[model samples]
Target: MPSFAQILIALGAAGGALAAPFANTTAAAVTTEQRSAAQTFTGDITYYQPGLGACGETSSDSETVVALSPAQYDGNCGKTITITKDGKTATAKVVDKCPSCASGAIDVSSTVFQSLADMSVGRTQVSWSFN
Candidate 1:
């Protein structure tokens, strides 16, 4: 037969082992909650040239172009879009669609382009994500 002290120690060890799984599960839940709170997703796209009278004389650098599926062009004009260029991010509404876009470039306004990246040069590398 085991002594009383030995029996108590064995019970304590078994209890801890059983609690391990629950502790791990709680930790995982906390991590998932934090990730959901900090969720920020971004989409990648290209930049294209703007059309005449697009943004009312905004410079090339401050312009952006988003491809529309014909119907989405005029209907979703005021939809908000968050654009991240270089390291800066700017939020703007979808105003116009570039009819001359190459394949996957979405056109934006000159002010937005300038706020997000340097438009002085021809084109800039940008990553666009919406939330």
Candidate 2:
């Protein structure tokens, strides 16, 4: 006895109600992972020229590319990291390995380094985590 418009409205309402629980579950999962993914550590950060890097990736100043220590690079290649310093933060992709860097040092592209600190500073203490 319900009209076509009424039937569609009822179906839409039911569909929305059914989808709400799934949506909330997905949102909760994402929030939980984001909370756990943040692991902070202090390190020395410096800038480098944009060019071919040890990971065989060609980069430029315009891109947010970063070089990690050999150990970090082995596991983090092609992953993103969020670096923070002097109350500023920048996110960059791990694209290369830094054999010369100390165990906790990281080298970022000129743009990413500048985002966290002035180029004249050359190097600064930074905290970073995988995003």
Candidate 3:
């Protein structure tokens, strides 16, 4: 015969097991949707570095612009933007604008470039397709 303590534990376990199904059903019934919002810009449209100031300051540090797909320009900045180069996809951000940027190209901050591509890489032939 089980001790009183053992019977209480067994009853507790059975109660927990019985509640598990209802708990799971309730949890599954709740719907969770992840939202992806786009970023909107309407100012002078420029980015600045630590000491360099605005887009144009140092000629040696001319900004680099990488062309992105139509989907890439969904106007999202805070969110991560996927960049693909040499069959490798890297995540970067839509930080700033390059007045000198070629058509369909986007100019990311040097910090962002360092994150997605190596510093020595200069410029990476990449394509961005965002959601």
Candidate-wise lDDT, in order: 0.55, 0.85, 0.47
Candidate 1 stretches with Cα past 4 Å from truth are 1-75
How many clashes in each structure? 13, 0, 2
Q: Estimate TM-scores for all models.
A: 0.42, 0.68, 0.37
In model 3, what is the error at residue 59, expressed in angstroms?
21
What's the CA RMSD of model 1 in angstroms?
A: 11.6
Candidate 3 segments whose C-alpha is farther than 4 A from its true place:
1-79
Q: How does model 2 fare in lDDT?
A: 0.85
Best-fitting candidate, measured by TM-score?
Answer: 2
Arranged by lDDT with the best first, the candidates are 2, 1, 3
Candidate 1 lDDT trough over 10 residues, lowest sum:
64-73
